[model samples]
Target: MAKRRRRYQNRHGNRNKTKYIVIGIVGLVIMITTLALTLLVKNQKITLKAPWTLEKSTRIKTPEETLRTYFSYIETKEYDKMYELINEESKQSVTSEDFIARNQKIYEGIEASNVQIQITQVDDSSELGAAISYDMTLQTAAGEISFPNQAVLTTTKEGNYQYLIAWEDALIFPNLTKTDRVKVSISQPERGAILDRNGNLLAGKGVASSVGIVPGKLNEDPTQDLNQLAELLKVSVESIEKKLSAKWVKDDSFVPIKTISKLTELEQTTRYTSDETLEKRARNDALLSIPGVMISDTQVRSYPLGKAASHLTGYIQQVTAEDLEKHPNEGYLETSVIGRSGMEALYEKELKGINGCEISIVNEEGKTKLVLASLATQDGKDIQLTIDASLQQALYESFAEDKSSSVAMNPYTGEVLALVSTPSFDSNDFVFGMSQELWDSLNEDERMPLYNRFRQKLVPGSSFKPIIAAVGLETGDINPEEDYGNAGLSWQKDASWGNYKVTTLHETSPANLENAIINSDNIYFAKTALKIGSEKLQSELDQLGFNTDIPFEIGLSKSQYANEGDISTEILLADSGYGQGQILVNPVHLAALYSGFANDGNVIKPYLLYQKQVQPQIWLANAFQMENANLIKSAMEQVVSSEHGTGHAAYREDIVLAGKTGTAEIKASKEDKSGTELGWFGIFTSDKEVDKPILLMNMVEDVKERGGSGYVVRKDKEILDQYFGTQQ
Candidate 1:
């Protein structure tokens, strides 16, 4: 009975212990549930997955987005951000300094600040990476450089998210490796050609040998190479040094010393071997033997007509620093040649085409690994001028040893057939480089060879009598048939002013408009001018395009007419009537003035560009009444056909030429009583059978020894005969 009771007590005690344990477990469960509820209310994220799965929850950057960011950093030059974005493997391979150095090499001679990068497209087809195509542009001294480019982006895992960009040299430029670099090569476009109306070549590109030195390839000191090249080429060593010392010339640049157009001429100047000997010796071998000296083919401006068209064609020269600064956005390169004057300058933009380039990947040895992209260069347009090459050549030769200027044009169309200013320079000399001695000679020449005499102003002398007659007839001051008694060889405002006599070359007792023009009667014209008064005479001159700028492609000096103030004095008015006062006119203006008479008082503007058909600008419509213009034309005809005509020497039986002659006295000073005279002759044909009536004006400066107006008239006859085929 005692053993049964003990077993029952032990059983009860075990049951109580088990119940206490169960209550503790229930309390712990309640606490855990309350904490979970608080966490849920706060919206805290709690992953119930593995650490690897947590990575999936974090944001992973897209390959395109990563590449866009990379490009932005590159464009902004944020090297820190760029470095951070680079893959760990790439960073380990290259240091920050190395990366910067590599970029510097890519734009060694360029202004990196002006570089622009734009991502044009992005393709993310691969699971691990993306391909980004872009365009890179750089503003250089040579011009704008634009090319298409491509890059690659890859993904990588970070702490909790996957980052993109497996950076490498190849990522900066597609197909470029860590060991490879990029090289840029520029190809210049062909400049336009200049042609004459006859389709004859005036100025064009010609192949020539350019002698230069590559400093990096030099086998000895630069001084030694310069000396050797100078001796071989028969040029001063200083010149070679000056060329190589240019600011833009780099160690790898090929510095040009000179260009040789005619090998025979070079041989003659150097007293060297002939072409046969040069060939036997091998031109390349001889040039290569001189340290850094090299010979390469280059384009040179060739003026086939030499000095015949120098003034019209002008010349081109290397662009200066001032040129670049003035035109920052014009894309002018330091190595470019620009037109300095004449038509070349007037049409520079049309003649200079777009320059192209090739962006390539190269090795350390300077070998091209791949051509990433290329742009084809565009050639410039060809320009054709209105000048008749044959007529121009003939007229230029006619000037011979004379220092003169002349203009021959079609009166009806205002097309300039010939515009010649004698003693012109050799344009070829300027193309290569004019020597200091030659330049000095031209500037010092007493004849003023450098002056464009055709565009310069000169006194019209008695040739202005026709304008005075027109003024008188138009103002009704005098009739074409009304006679103003010829006042002997001299006249004055009155007998009281006897010492201030106005002299004439003729002594006709009764001089009408025809008689005055035929004799070039200064006295007769002077009296007519007084009758018309200074106001009316000045108005007539204004209508004749005086004291106004002539609109032409090539610039012209304004022709001047005497102001009312200038003709205030009676003696001054008399002098001005015969173009002896402050009256000045250029050859072009004189031609246009006469052209009006031939076109029935409608003056046409002269032009030299044939491609652009410029409408005729009437300087003065109805400058003179039809009757007055006819009267002037008839009197001018008498000046050549009549027995007493001063320009009788210009009369052609077959051509029926009409003209005037003048002898203008040039005073040494305002107080001088007398000075040298300039002879002048202006002639035109009245034949309707001629396709284009030609008006020619010829002048001889300081004709003290060359005779007077008669001499100029005879010369005109010769020129006219040659031009019109009316030679006897």
Candidate 2:
């Protein structure tokens, strides 16, 4: 015990207890002070690097808050609300409706698939702004997906950091990120003005003041506003109510409900009530607020002559659900002026320009609190067409007599001077949507006004006679002066009794190609077809741009030619020689083929668009000249110049017009004259001064029993009258 006590006292006594204690206390205090100072400095400054080296020390957003704001939109189907929260700048560039519509399709297969988000890295004190990295595990209906997203948020003058517009995250989802929006305004393009070559306005988008509506801005009764709107706009109350209800449901804020369009002073003054004027105390308060019902500036599409260029220009319609399915990103609201047909459909891309948008913030009730993004709407581009409105009007009037069609083209350039489809409907019917009554009438008419008959199928008849004669002479089947006995019928059929017979219009027999075409002698041409054989004849015609379809801006029916495999007899040859049996051609195809005659045996492909200036030619290459094309031109010229010509009545010595006429029977029942025949006329000028021949072909279908000939004669005359005037 004494030894133990001595050891303990020695150990305690030997050490300087106060000094050791002071040293240990000082070491502990120094370590704590170092840690405290390190933590204080670390928490106070955050270093971050940006694209532009923007640097700042600021409080960072928590991962939870970011995820809540980002994913909350997916949980609730409030896509419009979600759009509002996007960086204001981006919101202005994108259409809210378009975004919602696009997301709706993507989200249809995704539900409550939790998105796991984690911040990986952050850079501070850099000119590029705050760099944030996120790791996300997204769950979709297809499978679980994971990806990393990053962005740099730039600091504004308010010290609040906003998203960078050109970043990877912005590319993937521009509407969701805070740093991806644009803040610039847009200027709408001026409304396009349409003018003819002579500077006459036929169709144009004109500037006219309009009334707009903001559905969220109303304080009065909905019915009162509706009634007031109806009285002001001179429309039914039901229509205003419907429009208002739609605006409310769609939640449109910027676009106003138009109460009137292109209003007169008298019409504008009638909007006020008598009670407001009589009561002096309430005069200032007479104009009650209405949601979406207000006057504003707007552009309107107008056709100066109303229906003058309806078919060629076509019309516009609001994009439907089908359009949305085809273009999910374009959205419904912005795609209002879709081209319905004609030139409008062909040039849609050039016409519709960039769209403008705005980003706005709304409260829980869907009230807009702030505009987060903004840009003005841009206007569409303008197009100048080759159609001549005045000539179009004149042609329209000429074809008004009967169901007929006419097409005029410059043989050299292939520019269409006139393209008229007869028994036509007023284009105004399609504008603003057609009425059920007019739509039914258009569809029910026997004339088939909607059909572009110039491109429709028809037997060429005697118009093909010149073509057959040319084949015979080229193939050495017949000499120019070869004698062919009429016998009142072809070699395939006997005409002993002269009952079922073909006859020459002239009493004497034709001695050459000129005489043959002049009288349109069926017997001579029919015999020529037999001698050359249908195979060789068809080959020559096909090579000269016959029986084959020609390509254009619109679809066309192919011309029909008898295949060698399809025919085996002289009887078929005889019928085809007279443009019957199985031969059919459109006026445009035949008119183009006739270019060979004027072009000195070289048939040029028919075209609607100019080639050298445009990247691609609108017409197909079906043009070629056979070794003996002159044989055809020589004969056709006589049909108009010769005294005994079938087209003698149409001949003009002054202009030297060469042409061929045809009449094809349209049979219904074996005994019915109730069927009509199509009459055709193809013509061109013979003057040397005319560098290129002008070609015109007109066709009139369904003239029967008026005469034994089964052709519409007056309609053919009307077409010739116009052709002569225009050609001159």
Candidate 3:
């Protein structure tokens, strides 16, 4: 029985062991599960990432290829597989076709064998967005070119970087050779012919037979060589030498020589060159051969009209070092042609074409071995202007005797028909390099031909009366028949000119807006302007294009707005009444202001270009029809057609002409009483039943003899009457 009990106890122990094993297994499983949970939770917490961080940085191998491909697609000139990858934002600015054409030259110049690019830096901007910098090396058969450039780009969702945009060289590049060299020639356009409104050539490129030398080709001293060259050209040796050394930096072995100068007249400089062969040959041997120079063909600038449109057309001048630095991408060289002013400066891109190059081989001995391929230089486009040459000549002839200015505009289109400023100088002076004496003489002249008097400042005087009168009628301050007694005296209280009595130029009493305008009665208009007050009158004038500068293509003068708030009422009334006290004007201002009467009441934006259209029944039929323009025209008609109108001298029944005259005072001194007067006339004419009118503004300045008189502007009536004829 004891044995049985022991056996039973052993069995019990075994059962207990089995129970512990089960518990151990269960605990181990629970611990392992807990650890795994902890590890998973920790990993999740550590790996949290931002949304933007999902993107990957990318690099393009061939950046120029990317740009060319993209530009082609952007320009819409080619259907390429790469175009599908364009950025969304860039599509808005230009069409694919235009984009291709714009970059046509740039792409054509690139060759796969010559391309080498070095990735510089990746940059981010807060405003301008992302961009990448690059250093490029272009190795062509002729030579190797290196440039630093940048491309603006954006990263895509797919993590690829592409070319967004690029730019060309901004600073002027140094010549390939290290020597003093020059190639002087004239510039001509082959695309379109430039002509005046009268069909006369204003500017066009003409060929001049020329010869130039590479500095290395010269055998003798540059100075002595230049001296010999100057003697051949019949110009001062100093001038020729100065031009040769103008922008040159001295270098070893290579000195440029220009043996044959530009043709003064295209009529066969061959005679000039041929006649002086022995002399030129001696100079060439003495000056050029020492340096191992080479001959080259060059371009130049020409002004066919010479002095006719000098100020208007402007002229070309040598590019300064500073200019080259500023416009590095301009591809300007020492011998490059630049438009200094006028239309040349205005449309420089159109007037300047891409420069091409040649790929020729040079032997180890520094000799050109074989003829190589070449990319010809492009000619600039022609420019046409609105100037009527005949009319401009006539106006110039008339105003040549004195300091005067005239402007004529097409009423319907606002195209300037003719603009003339007297005492003009030859534009050729700048091109040929004016002598110090001639330049000094022009500068010393009191008339100041360089000043565009048409744009000069002046007080409108009585010409302000017509504008004020129109404002009075428009704003209901005065009626057409409203009577105003001038009393031939002061109109504003405390006015500086109060003590001085005004005289009535015409026989009239207590006149209305009609009579006051006709006689140019200072008192009547002063009272009218005062009655209207500064705010009301200013508002009206501002609407009439008086306070603001009108939009026009050419450079314009700013119209002076009186500081009515700061000045006294008496001053305002006196100055504002006669158009003298606070306001300022120029020829352009008068012409535009007078247009209000010519166009009825509508104030249209003045323009010079005519938008050409097709099909007469469509847009062409309503091209120039303006509605509100008539309101201003009706008022101007009364200023000339009415019996008491101020511009009766301009009245022409056949043409339906109307205008106003003004004479402003120019104070001489504080105590001394000698001063000048300015004369002005603004006219608008209708030749027949028309959609628009013809406008003219004529001004004569510094008329000292007619001091403080109202008749100065009126004196032009005889000329106007003769030129325009009696319409009535």
Candidate 4:
């Protein structure tokens, strides 16, 4: 014990009190300061360079955690963070700035979306690094892409993850390299053609002259030259100037002003000319001689029949942004065109061909490294319609300076021969890009040149008598010899609780069903409808295609027997019998119903798609009894053949003709005289031969003072004469 005490005292004494204590304190303080500096540098709280630099501890705990963090940064588009997660060798190969820009361009260019990454496997046994296998999927403009990939994580000097991404271009996309290029090549498809029954072009591609001007090549004062050019092109000088000074116009650019259809010999001679030449060709040379005015041949949508077939073919316009959004992945581009109206719109799928798409990787030598996706180009289909171009033109020209709608068909075959709407505009103008002023004029015109009247429902007036006559005969309401029409210009079915009276233009005695139909006796048919009763009347009309849309390729307003499908009053039902009440009929549908007379009471459904051999399709069977339909057909034939017949003007000595006439009064009341009349004339051949017989129905507006139904009858005769003459 004494030796231990002595040793301890000696050790304490050797310290020399304050001197040894001061030395120990200074050493302890130096050690603590060194430890703090090392920690600060390691945590990045303080930056030290060269000999004093310290490696940071791993912030990411495990290889799996590191993988999640790396991918999470990518999902969040933290580009700088993504670059930082790579290993030293990868960083040396691709700088942080290059890596970020490269990824951003590729992703945005492809319109990448719906990114999803799933880790499939991970291997961290190697002391050198860790490896992760994953599946990735992303959507692109062309299609969806999915691939399996692997990411190698090299061992890092610092951080808890102990590994970093060994980055390469292949990590961004499967089989991609730094020197490779991603390309998307799109091939445009040619639009389809619209052809007539005989393979005539209704809407197709043809060469036209595109007129433009190069600003730098113009004279110092180009007003006079531009004025002359405008006059020849039928455009305003201001429009030419505006196009020349467009925002994208350059000194060498050819700023287009107008596209003029080539006045080829094949085109129908236009109106306002000797025999309707499109335009005066004498000015074309003068237009070309003007300074800076240049004409180039360009392909455009051609309209051969011009105004004759414009309403049937419709037009196409540039694809709108809204269309692109609504039809994403439909293979549409900015350069695409879309059908806007008429048969073009109804058969858009058959007209808009599929475009080609190619997504591939190209190497430095511009050789394809890999074809990611490829689709072959598909051209649009040619749509053929059952229309006779000659008949269409003849029908259109029949309504010169008149507002009219006409439909011609083969009564037995139900093949529509022609559909004509007068006061029409050139559809080619729309395809060439319509001017705002021209468009305004069409909309603001009181005549309504843009109106598609064939698709509209109009009052049939006396033309509806044949249908009522059929109804009466089929239901045993009236006999052909029994007289229902009285000898008076007007008659009333009872008092009807009002002063309304059924009036006829011509009074005849013994106005039986056949005679009533021939003279269009309003009271006789009115009484017949009352005898049929409202419920039965509606049912008959329904069977005849009222209140239902016609099964056709193009959309037309449905025919209606009443405003809301019910004839609630006797007066209403009586008025409807003469086609004057709430009854309205589409020209096409009415024509189809009239076809039943020639088809033995079977209403044949009309079709527009061309077929080599036509087989009649029944729309309504037993619409009328065979004898009743034949009786109506016989009366219509007499109406044209007999001297007292309203359609006597349409009579021809060489061929048998049948017809019915209607004059619809658009009046506020029964006594109103200051109203326009819609004249209707339905004519067809009743010959026993029955080969290629044509049934034509035409309607003319504002015919009240212009000769009533006679005006329509005369026009119908002229059209029929020409059509039949051609057939002969």
Candidate 5:
């Protein structure tokens, strides 16, 4: 019984020990589970086992990322996002609205485009802050701008963000400040003047009478006076009313109605009839008759030569959106004027001058804070032309009523003295803004007054005879003395010609080169072409600058031989010899060709730009033998000096004029009889006076019933008589 008691006590102790161990094991398991769960809830990942091997958290962005994102928002025009990417301290520097508005204004004003930014380098040396280096480029209106900049970033306590930018105006542009405002100042240079050889103002500054009405000085019941004023100024009543009702106009202010160009001395006699001039004067008197009608003189672009030199001087109009688009990066502005036609359009670059610009910082009161960059202004170059204004006016006046065109050149000096196309428009009217009625009249005119006849190619007619005769002599095709059987006015090649025959105006015997040319016998030259053939004649014409571009200040249509330089048949070749059958010559080119005759066989290129001194420029040196040119000139002299000659009407006693007359027929076929005639007279002074010598060529559209070339001869005579101071 004692042994049993001791074993039971030992068993009980062992059992107690096991119980304590079990309790301790269960408690240890619970503690470990709680620790694992707490770690999982805190980190949201199994990072407790290998914390160093795990990927870093992506919750907060780095300082470099914050800077890149801020610039990215700028590119997207998300200003609010950019503002949010900045720290609290930076936000205090500018309000959200102020930042957005400032950025928008600057970007839009400079027409910024193609924005680019690069994170050049990032010095992430400290945990609390970073210095990010960046480079940016912006294409602005002035030009492409590029700069390097630094943006400082700092650690932020803002939710879900680790870093933010320290905002400042310097981030917008290099060296930009809070008080400094970016500005672009443009300085417009003055437009150049167009002057003639004698310093006459062809297109330059002038004064116009500003017809305005003072509201206080206006007559009671101003309806009738306003209507009359509108009629006289060729403006609408509504336009006048609009000017009078301008916001800035006061009761005593001269509310300008319209500008009326004052008539020049030449315009008084030629631009209008006596009655019309009196009516214009009467309108001014009538304006004075109305109360409050004050005429104040104001400066404007003046055309002193008026209608006579309109084509030579051209005109100007306001710059358009299309013009600006077509010519990009070419210093153009909305307030500028562009050349519309003629010399003005041809030399736009030289006349417009370079505009000056300044990129600067300015205050609200326009006070300069800083000048970033500047460009000096360059004024336009003054252009002087070879045109003689007095001569141009006189020539235009002589044929003012006719559909005529004339070119007066100095053969000795190669100076184009005058270019006149009659029935012209006043360039001043364009400056003052042409009325609808006037514009319509100009367009509807049957004569095509707007057409540039001087630049046009016309049928040379008999005026081309001298050139053909010279070419014949040059190729040894015919001797000036050789007699080919006389056919008397009309002839044909052979039976192969069918009914087609060559016709002429005059009948003469012994169909030699001189007699044929003296009488302008078409059959004789047609025969001469058959003898010379197409190749030889074409070769000589090419040597004389045919089928080549005329090197004039203004562009000219090339003189052609045939349709694209093709003489398909003998008939066409024959027609070409007599200045017919697709043989078209530009008036300017023909004038240049004629220079050889008066210049001792040396054809000179016509020039319009006046230099310090007139330099004779040789175009076709020795186009023909000096002897051949003289022979033609000798016959031409007799044509005007002799009574029995064809051009006897132009016989001058003292001046000794020499020339050939031409009458070209425009026809579809040989059978067509109703075709119109182009009468021409090419003449030059025989006496060797270097300063006074002239090679003048004039043409009239129709002369069939008006005595053919004789009609042109009479007008030329009248003009020469006036030119040489021998009006008889």
Candidate 6:
């Protein structure tokens, strides 16, 4: 019985052991499942959180997100965050110091405002890494630059998952290695050429020799070499040093010291067979003998006619810091040259073309590895003007150093044939930089060489007689055929204006309309003004463009007919009729007025551009009736054709010239008892072959003799003879 009981107990014990093992297995399974579910929920792979829980969570970012964050840090210049994302292995290979140095070198001297970067897309084709495509834009002083690039990023395992930028020199820029760098090279465009009416070159580009220095390549101290060069070039040593100290100048930069147009103009003398040989030898000597000097061929602005067209063509000067500030983002550099005045300034944009550039990848040794991209520069457009070069030269020579101004125009079209302002300057001096002494001399000269006399105002004197005659005929105040008579050498308005008599140049008392114009009788026109009344005279002047600014390309001072609140008394009205008392005019204005009479009372707008066909603009379509215009023309013709005409000096039997002359007294001061006279003359001729009559006006300041008008009349004949080829 004992044996049987022991067997039963052993069997029970065995059963109990099996039950405990199963319970332990179930408990282990429950714990394992709960931990797995908690991990899944934390990673956002599953939503198993309690319903009452308010907190939200997210999974580890993908490779694309990692790359986006990295680029965001780069854009904001958060270098620390960017560095933290670099792979540990890459950090070990390249220290943070080395990485930062490489980046700084790539972006050296670039302003943050001038740089822009964009991440376009991430190509995650591989499980271990992804490729990032981006576009980078940089605005440099030279120009704008844009390029496409790429970077590589690799993944790593952390608490969940994260990414690390696969570090390589190429990651910064595609195909850029540790030993490679980027370089920018500039190519300047050729400036535009200025041409005359006949396609004659006025201002254009010419070759010049520029002496420069490569500071890094110098064999000796720059100070000694620069001193020797300065002595040879006749420049100050301090000037050379200052040029070398420019912001753009560097150890590897080519700093230009001076430029010379002609080899013969150099101070040093070296015998050679020809000019070409001499220039070659000089260039060689400058490059080889000087320790730091380098000779190069450069472009310069050339004025072919020099002083003859200085005032018209003006000059170009180097761009200043002020110019860059005023015109930000205009792509202007320190090396830029800009037009300072005249047509050059007016057409600067047209004359300055688009610049181009070359981007290259250079090695650590500064050797060009590859040409990344290139763009060719575009040349500026050429400008053609209406001025006849030969005619301009003739007019300039005719002045012969006299302080005078003149204008010759076609009446029907208002095409200015010759515009001359004497005592001109050499534009080339301004181009290369005029010396201080020379500039002071020019500025201090009493003749005012820089002043544009063609735009200046002067008293019209009796040259305005024809316009008054037109007013009389148009107003019906006087009959052209009737004899109004000179009245006398002097006349006054009753006794109230006693001792205020207006005198004339006439020696006779009785004068007809034709004779009054021929004699330029001031008394007759003064009396005629009284008949028409002062109010009508003012209205007539207003209709004739007085008290208005001349609409010209260049600035012009407004011409005046009367003071702002002038009293129109009999004495004042008398003076007004004779072209005195606040009656001021410019050559251009007078030319336009005279042109009206020649064009059947239509005033044409003057223009200087001839590249296209320009239609004539009529300032006044009908300034007077056709009969009245014809009557004035006939009377003016008699002023030259008539034997006793005051403008007899301008008489030409074969050409049939018509003109008027005046000698205006300009008071030295308001209190001065005596004053100097200004000479004036105007002439025109109608030729059948020419579509419009050619009109000319001359003005000479401070004429010594009261008979100065006669001198001007002779000059008018000479100019006409030269223009029309010696009329028989």
- Using lDDT as the measure, what is the rank order of every candidate, best first? 4, 5, 1, 6, 2, 3
lDDT of 2 by residue, 1-728 (tens): 99999999988876878778889999999999977864553333221111111246542233222223444455456667546435556656677786676555445433324545555665646664566566555544324545566655544333223433222324233233433232222334433444554556655664444554566665556677766765554456766556666634554554444422244344446656456333522311232344555555565666654444555566666677787677654422443666676656666665665456544333445555555434466566666654556666766776666677777776555666667777776544454345466778889998777766766767888887767766676678988776565454233356442333444445436446667777776777777787888778877766665655575565567777664445466666677887876787877777776766666555555554333353323232433344456556666677667766566565654566777877776776435556777777777775546643467777776655443122333444454566455432
Residue pair clashes in candidate 6? 485-511, 486-511
The ten-residue window of minimal lDDT in model 5 covers 45-54
Q: What is the C-alpha lDDT of each candidate?
A: 0.74, 0.58, 0.56, 0.81, 0.79, 0.74
Superposition error at 71 for model 6 (Å): 8.4
User: Per-candidate TM vs. native?
Assistant: 0.72, 0.62, 0.60, 0.80, 0.78, 0.73
Q: Summing lDDT over every window of 10 consecutive residues in candidate 4, give the lowest-scoring window.
A: 45-54
Q: Lowest lDDT 10-mer window, candidate 1?
A: 45-54
- Using lDDT as the measure, the top candidate is 4
TM-score-superior candidate, 1 or 5: 5
Model 4 TM-score, all chains together: 0.80
Give the winner by TM-score. Answer: 4
Better of 3 and 4 by lDDT: 4
**Could you give candidate 3's per-residue lDDT for residues 483-544 as a string of tens digits?**
76546544335456555434345644757765676667777777777778777777666655
lDDT of 6 by residue, 213-249 (tens): 8877876557777777876665788988888788999
Candidate 1 lDDT by residue in tens digits, 1-728: 88889999999989999999999899899999977864452333221111112234665455544544554554355565556667777788888888777765665434333555555666777777677676766554345656677766666776433455566776555577877878777777788988888799888887667888887787655676666677556578787778777899998898888775545455534556766756634654666788767778787988877777778888888899999997665547888888887777888888877677666788888899987566678777888888888777877777756777788877767778777787888778777677677789999998887878787888889987887787788889987777788588877877766578888867875677788888888888888878888888877777777777786777788777654444677777778889887888887888788876676767778888784654656767887777777778888998898887888877777777778888999987545866778888888875646755788887777776677877778777777777777576
**Each prediction's RMSD to truth:** 15.5, 16.1, 15.5, 13.0, 14.2, 14.2
* Poorest stretch of ten by lDDT in candidate 3: 45-54
Pairs with steric clashes in candidate 5? 462-662
Clashing residue pairs, candidate 4?
A: 58-159, 58-160, 269-276, 270-276, 270-277
Write candidate 4's Cα lDDT for 610-669 as tens digits. 999888898888888888888899999999999999999988887888889999999898
